[model samples]
Target: MNLQSILSQHIIKAVSESYAATLENIEFQATRKDFEGDITVVVFSMLRTVKGNPVQIGETIGEYLVANVAEVSKYNVVKGFLNLVLSDAYYLDFFTSIQNFNSYGKVPATTEAIMVEYASPNTNKPLHLGHVRNVLLGYSVAEILKAAGKKVYKTQIINDRGIHICKSMLAWKRYGNEETPQTSGLKGDKLVGNYYVKFDKEYKKEINTLVENGFTEKDAKAKAPILLEAQKMLQKWEAGDPDVVALWKKMNGWVYEGFDATYENIGVDFDKNYYESDTYLLGKDFIQSGLEKGVFEKDADGSVWCDLTDEGLDRKIVLRSDGTAVYMTQDIGTAIQRVKDFPDINGMIYTVGNEQDYHFKVLFLILKKLGFSWAENLYHLSYGMVDLPSGKMKSREGTVVDADDLISDMAATAKEISEELGKIDDFSAEEKTQLYKTIGLGALKYYILKVDPKKRILFNPEESVDFQGNTGPFIQYTYARIQSILRKAASASGYTESVEIRNLTLEPKEKELLKILQQFPDVIQLAAGNYSPALVANYTYDLVKEFNSFYQNVPIFGAENPAEISFRISLCDAVGSVINTAFSLLGIQVPDKM
Candidate 1:
């Protein structure tokens, strides 16, 4: 057991024996820097059970702990805080107990499983900055859940149908003189995206012409030839017209190839993919069953609605009067389908933006009302929009920061900064290129993930690549430094192997490092419970900062004895291992050399 649990048990015993009162729990916090203790217990919280002045109670508890607990070497009372100084032997034992730091904090997989849905992008345009955030958050959360001992499946639902898709198909067929991604030297999604922009431009021109001929603005828009053709194309596609269906499959095929490239570039993948064309009509049967069960009502026009007024939400449409299923209907069916597909999964997390918060709230509520056992475990991982320092993005106008371009730009930025620093002067050309990509991607992922999901991000690429102060490069650099130290220690005579340090004296910096290291497993558990990668990101930054302080103030190879050198090197190795594991959880890579 950890020190906190051990201390809590003993402190509760002390409070009961001394004050003749039953204490239910113990409250503990990190010892203050000004104070000389390893951990601090808040005596103020114990007053409810132990009737005495806070300071007096703290002294009585401290006296009992020092006399009884072997770990508690000494103690001091500051106001109402009981600060316990643990023996050096306790920390030494902790260091020796860890068999392997590389897999140190992760728990073995449990029977429970979870499904995380992210990057459910539409087929109309290439993924942009907003999708980047969604993909990173979802991927990291899945990895964190796995580390926390849950079986996790990463998935996405591709929005591959509807008029938005037809717009691109119509534009590409009408405007291009038989241009293809191969012929045009453009990514398939970008090629399709270009046509999508073209359709909007042509549709606007038609609307303007009709308006000039004395038609109202609304009527002109409704009567635009390009939009009308696109709508007709959608109808034809829905009717399973051979020509239109073939065209959709061909165009959608191109876009899929483009999307795969981007997903690979960003280092994220889905275990399963659900297509709108396949799942869109799935909930129609469910709607009929719901109506028969009184879970839904039929309107005068024969439309189906779920009355949620009692639940503080307005009536939601499930099926149209014409028996056409709505997005809500499709979503309900898709959620149920996922459970059927993964029988062991007890929960799911949707990683969509905050704009759809209300939609998910209604979806989850309806599921619960339908009596699904897993509905209570559903969560909406709602996150704010990611804005660039310049401004917001609009996809139709083709002004959004393309994911492919942004990734390339990040690498370019890393190269520029690295050339200025001249740190990789000795690296070969191929080595330098790979290192640049690692550092660049690491900077991008860390900057976005280090913030709370609920908060909006104003991303700055140049700022993220900085090599100092809470940035990815700074932490990566520290990790690389530790690796270099390990290499040096391995080559030095008499310091190549582990040393038994049962009787070694502990330095202040070494104890501080140990204290921070001890919190890793607990931090992983906390991050998993909260569905927050920000917790893990910030914890890693704290660990890196403490390690840097230790590295500067304490000498490893120059220590007075080989045993001290061996111990310090071992600590360096542990810190490096953690940095790697932590970065991996965030979908970031650490470099052995920067």
Candidate 2:
């Protein structure tokens, strides 16, 4: 058991023996910074059961703990808080017992399985800054879940079929003379995205011309010839027109290649990919069943709707009057298909933007109403949009910051700052390039993951890559520093394994570092439970801060004794291992030589 569990058991015994009163539970908090204690027990909570002055009660518990608990070296009663200082031997014993620091806080895989769907990008455009956040959040959460012992399958649904796609195809056909990714030297997605913008521009011009001719703006927008043609293209594609299908497949192939390069650049991958084209028709049969069972109602227009009004949500359409499936139907079908694909997956996490928060709520409720036991385990990892300092992005106007561009800019920024620092003089050109990529992507991932997923971020590349404060480069530099120390220690003593630390009084700084290191496993579990990488990110920052304080205040290689030096070096090794493990969970890489 951990320190807290041991202390709680002893505290319960102390309270029972001292006051002859049984306690049901104990409340604890981190010791205040000004207080000389490792953990604080709240004495005021006992007042609800055993009536007495709070101070007297606190003193009684503190005295009882010091007398009864072996780890409790001393205690002080500060008001109703009983601050208990743990013995240095306790921390030293805990540190010495840890044999493998590399895999220290990770858990073995459990039977329970979860599917995390992220980076569900549309095939029409290259990934943008918004997708950057989604992929990073989703990937990190999946890693965190794995660390917490769940069998996780990473996947995404490719949004390959829709009217938006038809717009791009039509734009390409009307404007281009058989241009392709190879001939244009543009990524398939970017080329298609350019056409999408072109279609919007032309469609708007048509709308304006019709309005000038006395047509209502709404009617003009709907009646625009380009819009009508795009709709017809969609219909033809749906009807399996061979030529239309061929064009759709060709364009989607290019987009998929573009998306693959982007995902690879960002260091995120998936175990499976679902296509909208295949899944869109999946829920029609389910909708019929829901209608027959009165779980859904058919409107007068012969459209199918799920009446969620009793559940406090508005009615959601499942199928159009023309018998075409809606997005909702497609999603329901996708969920069922996934369960069929992975029978062991008991839960799913949809890592999407917060705008579809209600959509997920209704989806989950409908699944539960459909009598799926796993629906209760479904979660929507809703997150806010990422805004640059410039402002919001509009995808259609080509104003969104492309994911590929942002990643490239981050590397360039890292290269500039690292070159200015002049810290890698011994590195070759290729090594330098690799290190720059590591630092750049690490900064990007860390900066985004460090924030709570629900909060919008105003990302600044310069700030994230800085080597000071709560940034990725700062933590990475510290890890490099520890590696340097280890290399020296190995050269000096010819020993790299952990040494047994016995009968030595650890310095305050050493004990503090060990205390923080011990909390890593708990932090991972907490992060996984909340599906928040921010918790893991911030915890790592705190650990780094603690290690820095220890490094500055204590001596390792220059220590007077061999045992002390070995113990300190071991501590440094442990810290570096943790830094690497934590960064891995965030999908960030750490460099050995910085």
Give one digit per residue, the lDDT tens place, for model 1 in 263-299.
9999999999999999999888888788888999999
- Estimate the TM-score of every prediction: 0.98, 0.97
lDDT tens digits, residue span 367-402, model 2: 888878888999999999987666788888777888
Instruction: For each candidate in the order shown, give its overall lDDT on alpha carbons.
Output: 0.91, 0.89
lDDT of 2 at 531: 97
State residue 233's C-alpha deviation in candidate 1, in Å.
Answer: 0.2
